[model samples]
Target: MEKKLTKDDLKEIENQLSCPSGSKGIEVAVSMNVKNISMTKASIDLLKIANNDVILEIGHGNCGHLEYLLNQAANIHYIGLEISKTMNQEAILNSNSLGTSMNTSFELYDGEKLPFENNSIDKIFTVNTIYFWKNPNVFLQEISRVLKKNGVCILTFAQKKFMQTLPFVNTKFKLYSTEDIILLVNNTPFSITDTIHKKENIKSKAGDDVDREYTITILKQ
Candidate 1:
């Protein structure tokens, strides 16, 4: 018999979705692995990475995408900032396994401030990480600070309506419509270059395949 999702299971899913710390056990790991595949591909597709660009990924859980990106580009440097120590360690190990450690690095961040210097990064991207940002403006400012002039930032998240369908996405997850995100970015130094909408099939908490709508917002600083 298949196990049904309980309140505890939902809560664990919520925690993993917000910030995957790898402590919730195998179920969370399985969910995150599925999410990583789709979200990483979506974010990377928007990047259009160049051979020598210095790219950064915020809240990169497991850094699987980083390994892929590093392998795709010959001379590009990739940096990852993650808040979860377990995920950070896992990402490091994954990079080592890919033999891309020289081109990739991972660091633990508080999600409020970035460790990069001003105008240091050529490109940046994140997937499913905006909801957990306590102060969006501060984080946006930090992103603007670290990004070089005319650099690009791609942020990917599920649309509000689709996000609302998830029982686990409660008050803890700050759901946003495309308009809301555009308005928020308008207040910053960045301007929206493009927005891509995609529908993907993913597993629900009940282990059922469901369609989810995600939006990738491309911004230029």
Candidate 2:
């Protein structure tokens, strides 16, 4: 039998999908490990992380993927930027529990500004967080500013057609097609180097099977 979602459950899912800010949101994020696993794998694979690479992840909820990245390469420094205070702290705790605290750090921010020096980051990546970007240009500019010359940035998100099938992607969520994302990035200082598309079936919070199309766009700073 398919499990049903309550109104509060749906609300919490929406919060997790959008911003993931509070205690309830943190719980929802932890529960989403299954969905995040594949996306994280794809993003990491696209990242091509090297030894001693300075990497930053935007909107890293619960930091489960950070553990995966740390385990992939030794001495790779990672910084995570999240707008949610609870999630920021939860990610820090998650890293500590995984024994990755030595190389990982989390920061709470307003989602538009980045707190890194110019040309300081070697690589950056974000997954499933673009919908919550209040100002895409500002975030893109920040990414360009912090990334060293020829640094890589990988962005992973579900395409608009697939995202529209989800009930929680309401007005609060900003949906974008592949072209829209390309256009947005073209306006930034970075250049789109490659785009990878994949389709997968996943069960929704309401326990219904849904088909999702994931896009990973690699950019060079």
Candidate 3:
């Protein structure tokens, strides 16, 4: 199991994402979008994030999308937990530098045991990292502790069905299929809301099969 990343480790991850050509969000989104038609459809639903909800993300990884989402939601309070210091700091600095007035907090915290009071969150989400948990049961339980009743959580990842379609598959990251994720969801405290399978196509990619991802949404029950 991977230990919680330290500040230096966070910075290392940040440096990698800041590379202009490919990024954590861009790469994942591109591959996922083509993996299935439903992948893009599901991500579009992510924009339904309410203006007044308290939103949280477990593995922000220096992502720009969540911050952009926050900007779109002036009445929403957003928080992101990133294990990497550089990624967290870059997110803070770059986001603030953009001069938006959204209220937000970024913490260097353990993704497994979020340090929030019970029933404190309105909405929670993560992407591409839940399977790495050494104890996913405990991890989801912790998330349940902080979420309000009826609050929603969306977990998205690369689809196992799309393995044949990846433009460049990195063996480092783990991947799961929709059925696999549904089992984990069933074991958790949340009730399944929707499972969206989507395929994304990259410009000039050789095969039509490349780049699909699935996003699953569940409501805290």
Candidate 4:
């Protein structure tokens, strides 16, 4: 039997999920890598990655899938951005260890503003990061600003209904339904080219089996 987590324990889990740090954060990063791999792989496949494509991934925790993304194409340059210093450093270490350092770069960001120049990136994708966006509208415009014309952006997140069931989600997470996200995207510079609905049976943070319903919204300018 497992001990129950207190409110403080849940809060710590929430904080770590938002911006991991310290030794515990490193552990969280690893856990996230394992839990998020399916969504990450789906997002990458939606990218339809091509040769020499410059790809950007937001909130790439530990980026355990960097080698997988690099394997999708030839001459692909992958850039991972995170608000957590621990994730940034851990991703670098993981990339080096995977021998994917040559084609990948990691950076820390303020989470509101992207670091690349306008029209610079060929493809972009983010998994489970939209809930933390300070301003989803402004951030969508920033994504449009950096993404090249016709560039694809894959946004994946579990729906509000599913996310709300999690004990640690709390007020820190701004949950959304599929309708909510489509409406938000309509106001941005990009158009919703595709929305893929996904479901998986995964263990919850507190260690229980649950059905997770998520979405992969593909955006293009």
Candidate 5:
């Protein structure tokens, strides 16, 4: 039988999920890459990438899907921004291992402001990272500012109800529903172009079989 998690264990999981670090953080990131692959692919599809497009992904833990994303189009450049140093290094290492180092780059940030100029990026996306945004409203503006006119930003996250069931999602995590996110977007500069709710049968991080409910919110400036 699997060992039960203690209070400290759950808290550690929550912290690593937010901004991974150390050896435990590395392990957690690898697990996250597996768990979030489907969500990542779905978000990538919504981006509608084209030839020579500049793509940005926030909180790209280890970026194990970089090859799949690069194969979407010709001559694409991918930039991964992360708050976790471990994740930043791991992504670069993984990209190198995949022989995709030339076309990809990874950087660490404060998770508050994006380190790019206005109207710089062609497409932006983030999966399961919305819950950690220090200020969604202001950060949405940053996303808008960095994106060129008519740029697409796909935000994917599990619904509040589903996320609440996770043992590791503690007070540090801010869960949201479809309605809550829609309302939040309404207050931003970008307009919601599409909202997709999806469910999948998968094994949870805690090693339990369950149904996962998530949403993909597409935004345009």
Candidate 6:
């Protein structure tokens, strides 16, 4: 047996930390991805968004984050992109279950190739999914093509800044840094808007109390 932080690591992590037993109910597996922030605090940042904004949520697992975002930006139009139909369908169901959504919807599409017109979206957000993007440059370019001028993208990860938090620990994980992501985004049409590093504790799928640090990066077109 080997220990590594690859796609298998994440998939196993997602499976372990999922709340509730079985695939029944809303199946909030992805919630563990952002458990460090406590879903409640994540909602606060989403509250700052303006009303009637056009939003695009990428790699939406079950729409828990989207539901929180919708609370503040009521008039916003939201579309979710997910590669897995099962996860995408679950996200749609979750969004609809949260009291008859009016402007929120879900789509089963690959995040690398989004179907959107140029300068159409006002804001974009992703949690715990950015690092998994196969072609980050193309993904960013597609995002740039769809973002309106002044539109912003906020990417928050539960463990992106793990390298900083565990400086003395050596782990077999491909820990991505804020600078790495910034460079990736900079290569696209968008530029960095803001970068903030913060500490947040999370409960892992294994029920381990893990303190994860994330660097929140805002990219603007």
lDDT of 6 by residue, 20-115 (tens): 234632344555435633533462384257888887877666666665667675587888887766676777777778864677877777557788
Error of 1 at 49 (Å): 1.0
Model 2: weakest 10-residue lDDT segment is 1-10
Which regions of candidate 6 deviate over 4 angstroms?
Answer: 1-11, 14-47, 159-174
Q: What CA root-mean-square deviation does each model show from the true structure?
A: 1.6, 1.6, 8.0, 0.7, 0.8, 5.4
- Expressed as tens digits, the lDDT of each residue in 149-206 for candidate 2 is 9799999998999889876667678899999998898899988989999999987665
lDDT of 2 at 147: 94
lDDT winner: 4
Candidate 5: where is the Cα deviation over 4 Å?
none
Clashing pairs in 4: none
Residue 160, candidate 4: how far off, in angstroms? 0.4
Comparing 1 with 3 on TM-score, the higher-scoring candidate is 1
- Worst 10-residue stretch by lDDT in candidate 1? 22-31
Q: Write the per-residue lDDT of candidate 3 for residues 114-188, one digit (tens) a residue.
A: 989999998887765664555777888888889888677777676676643543334333457777767876888
* TM-scores for candidates 1 onward, in order: 0.94, 0.94, 0.71, 0.99, 0.98, 0.77
Cα lDDT tens digits for candidate 4, 63-174 = 9999889999999999999999999999999999988888999999999999999999999999999989999999999999999998999999999999998999997899
How well is each residue in 90-175 modelled by candidate 1, as lDDT tens digits?
A: 88888898888888888998889999899999999988889899899779989999999978999888899998888788767998
lDDT of 5 by residue, 140-162 (tens): 98999999997899999999999
Top model by TM-score, which number? Answer: 4
Between candidates 3 and 4, the lDDT winner: 4
Q: For candidate 2, what is the lDDT?
A: 0.84
User: Model 1's lDDT to the true fold?
Assistant: 0.83
Displacement of residue 109 (Cα, Å) in model 2 is 0.7
